[model samples]
Target chain A: MDFKKKQTEANLKPGDRTVPERKIPVPHRDISERAQEMIAAPYNVFIDWNLNPPTKDDWSKIVTKVSESSAPAVNKLIEDLGLTVEQLQIGGVKCYRLTPENIPENHRKQLVIVAHGGAYVYAPGIGSVREAAMFAAFGGYTTISVDYSLSYENPFPGAIEDMIDVWRAILTEYDPRSVAMTGTSAGGGLIMATILKIKELGLGMPAAIAPSSPWADLTETGDSYKTNEWLDNILVSYSGYLGLAAKLYANGNDLSHPLLSPINGNLEGFPPTILTSGTRDLFLSNTVRSHRKLRRARVPAQLHIYEGISHSQLSFDPDLPETREAYGEIAAFFDQYLIW
Target chain B: MDFKKKQTEANLKPGDRTVPERKIPVPHRDISERAQEMIAAPYNVFIDWNLNPPTKDDWSKIVTKVSESSAPAVNKLIEDLGLTVEQLQIGGVKCYRLTPENIPENHRKQLVIVAHGGAYVYAPGIGSVREAAMFAAFGGYTTISVDYSLSYENPFPGAIEDMIDVWRAILTEYDPRSVAMTGTSAGGGLIMATILKIKELGLGMPAAIAPSSPWADLTETGDSYKTNEWLDNILVSYSGYLGLAAKLYANGNDLSHPLLSPINGNLEGFPPTILTSGTRDLFLSNTVRSHRKLRRARVPAQLHIYEGISHSQLSFDPDLPETREAYGEIAAFFDQYLIW
Candidate 1:
């Protein structure tokens, strides 16, 4: 058939913005072709949500399943990195410690307190271990990943208070200057909130900190909320999973409460910090805003935005060339402050 | 040191965008971090010019090294996926054919012609087998990859002539409707140029084509040339490496010639086509423009832009969710026309 005839026959409105009528005749393949394609690949690395957020009840079920078993992943990390995994009672709250077998002598005293991020309610115990183990393996740091209380069971102050509990315990043993904090997504927001809470409680701050793509804005006020809505798959739109998680965590409290939304917090005396995020990350604006805030406060901060990466991809494959550059940047930054 | 005092000591002009005077005191590692970051993940997956295009002597040396061994990669693919690899001489030009162990009976007659990208100089011999084997393994299609001549010794029409020579032989054996043409980077441009050449030679066109981030423009006239310059690690800027490759391939020929620079070509009667590129891809503008041209011609066209990814990341990892999605989209599109 001629090009014009095929065009009319297919009946595709080439310029139409609408989903073109499926006149393109494609034959379906066998089940085997579909089976061969499944390679244990996890779904979207970024969150995915359309215009409306999920109902409260729907989110509750989703949270439970994601939180259920991260143990398998934790065990894999332990075996892969030859790291020691131990549980510690931090101010009565339990936290996991992941220390690599070979910590290059100088990095011995420095411990990174990891607050794992899963929008506040998911990926608790094993999440902390898996994330912390990579930090240990990549940066050669002993780590304490705080398994803070979740918004699912305790809501609002529960997670922040638990983060404080672990922070208090760490400060009690390690010299304030010898310690540091790091987190991703909600865990990242917790890091900023803890910094504020520490100041409020008259506790000394750590020597340095790194918050990788923190969900610092509880409200969908950042530019990326709209620009990166669909670009970021896992967190499709700000008002979806993130908003649902925020409402559940806030549990009727003001979304902009300084502790609840770290973007609104007072960031004074924040330690020399390094932050990371990706361009397509839904929380890219959140991360960018936080970096601007730190810069405004005249805090020495380094922000590394990996091109074309999604949320938390910096920590995804420790061996990926970009991932190594990311953590290597953190290790170099910490060397100046925490090595003492 | 007190936080307030250390802040002054560090002397960070947070908002000052003057590259920060480098006083952050990062101990330089063995390759300046910048130097270490430059790897030819095929550079642009289609274009790689180190600093400057080589003189005749240098080009000869570089070509020999790259052509020396693609065998190991081909062997690995054969072992990994139960696929058969065979060499064929089409119109006296060498090409590689890859076929899956079991072709679905209905689709056995259809085949995909791959034009491998290597700035027209690299990845010849086993490059075809490694890339084509994956399509056979994943998409269940027999793939024939043309190992076209490069500009190092044979410039301008050398590669395009070789591609047409192979295409002519393939068309003689298989019905034009039974074949689909696909390429990446330079090969993508080759597909467009060849289509124009095919029309000139009065050969029947293939049913469809898919070009993954084609180096469409031979000149630096695209918007992304400036926007995605430093952002795209591999193809840092159009003026740098791609420019050199374009110059070498054009060999002082008219760049605006439709056959030499496909972006300038008439896309009328073009086959149903799909194009892929990343947001950070330097050729993003090239891909977007080509899609526009096809759409203007009312040729059915689909473009998939992977978020924040650099050039040609679609084929970088066979197992990445995005890569799978990229290929899946093509296979589905091809099935629409090729199955009949």
Candidate 2:
């Protein structure tokens, strides 16, 4: 922890230097105790992934396991929030429609499209509905959770195409000005990519988008990859499964292609955006860079960074004050921008 | 940097665990070479002070040495930016007035006050003019840099009182609506504190303020204090001179006093504000928390965080793209809020 010592020239490239290993305890700061416990817990998804990538069957099995384990909690969340969920296929893309028991009058006609985060590989089916449940519960709006093609079966243009189809289909029933998008991690990145495509294909733009800890940069780019490498509890480093997942999803496409790394996209004419990330999230830079890109293009943008959080952990518990505040911010933003 | 392994129970507090020492190369992501070179260099101000705080005389000598060392570059910056510096006394507080050539027609009647940062102990005289010069050059407004009493010579209320005096005197000649304020690090904290005092005294508020890498929380009450401890490079940790400086500044007063730690202050009436920091900045959380507090109070606030840079290193070199962009953001914020 002594930062006074200077490293000697060890023949390492500037980008090749490693941050030393040290124990980072949960900071006793202004964050909630629940957040502290999450930080104190072991880093999430710390699997000893081998050199070879997981086969599609392996990924499918993993996804199924994760989905089964998460289903009970998602069901509880749906029931606790007085929401109803129905599986449907819109334009051949699988989706979940979550409707709250009591929608606010102002939000009765508003719609929020949800994209779930799973590294573009894991978390399918019921596992993808947790965020939708929280959005429905907190924002008091009907939500549609998009279940796009995972990289294990399909690759880059596949998820994008599926989301485009969903967006196109959703627009027929709801006013584009009443539609907004929300997602976390890979799902967050997908929403940004979907917006870019929406703008490019001449589809009407949504009112706003909230991308939480968006994995907007597919490559191991950005300072947080190095600074928050091991510090982040989830998605600890790009060298692990995150990098593999990025490669699988890119499917030989340049990772920097605006669609793969939406942070590099032309964000002009994009809708108002509110991004959320934690200080310890590995994609902290992705969220930060995405915010900067939006601001540079004169888009109205707001950013919320939670203390001691890693990845999309804020979405883990809707009862947490941080989660409530985040959803409140997004809802308020929607209220300001979404046409009645 | 494998995070797969959990730490063994080593009888360390969650806050006492040290981040392992590793070489952190300048990220090859989206930062300028100058910033990379800074991150690649030895940590700034890495002193070998013994296990005792410096005496006032020793502190004065240290400040003078730093000021002398920084003088040449500060002078060069003033000349290159075509700014004129004048010494003056307003309300018995020593100050530097920086006037830019070719002030914009809309900004001819506006004024900006600058507070220099040195952990509240250093950066006196010409050393304090760099930020003021940058503001004048980038913002095209006449700026007055307040040279408050150093904490070594005078503590908490000293800097606050001096700033309040400067504010009162400046307001006599300039409309509060046409004036703005900015500072870096300790100076940033001072501006926030002074504004709190200004409001308490029923003085009108400025149009906007930009505080870059503000040390707003004196009690090490944020995640960055621990997560960015050594990685920050500047103000390496609170246990070092930063802690000592905080103690000296607070004297016997409580560290969490709203005037000392403005992040906890009632920020309801704060003017439109913009905050800037970097991912590696030790005060990143301070900036984040301040923005959160301001937003919670319904104040319009924006945050800009550069990649890889630490502390207020953005103000170290005027020619760096990051520095130019930071100043541009501040200038634009001022233009949007300051009355014409």
Task: State the iRMSD of every prediction, in order shown.
Answer: 23.2, 4.4
lDDT per residue for candidate 1 within B100-188, as digits (tens), equals 88887656999998888766666667755555677777888899888888777788899889988888888778998978988888888
- Ten consecutive residues with minimal summed lDDT in candidate 2 chain A? A4-13
lDDT of 2 at A52: 36
User: How many clashing pairs does model 1 include?
Assistant: 12
At residue B167, what lDDT does model 1 achieve? 83
Give the C-alpha lDDT of model 2: 0.83
- Model 1's interface RMSD: 23.2
Question: For every candidate, what share of the true interface contacts is present?
Answer: 0.00, 0.45
Alpha carbon deviation, residue A164, candidate 1 (Å):
41
Give one digit per residue, the lDDT tens place, for model 2 in A1-340: 3343433223123343444456666775667887787777654433333233568677677777778888888888899888999999987899999999889999999999999998888778887889999999898999999889999889898998999999889888889999999999999999999999998899999999999999899988888987887677667667777888888889899999999998888899999999998888888889888887787789988888877788888888888888888889889989999998
Expressed as tens digits, the lDDT of each residue in A1-340 for candidate 1 is 8532332233222111111111111111111222112111222322323223355556566655555555776688688888988888889998888888889888887888988888886776665566788888888989988888877677888888888888777777889898888888888888988888888999878999898888887887654454444334345455455677788899999998988887788786899887777645667667766765675576777655544344675665555665666677678778888855
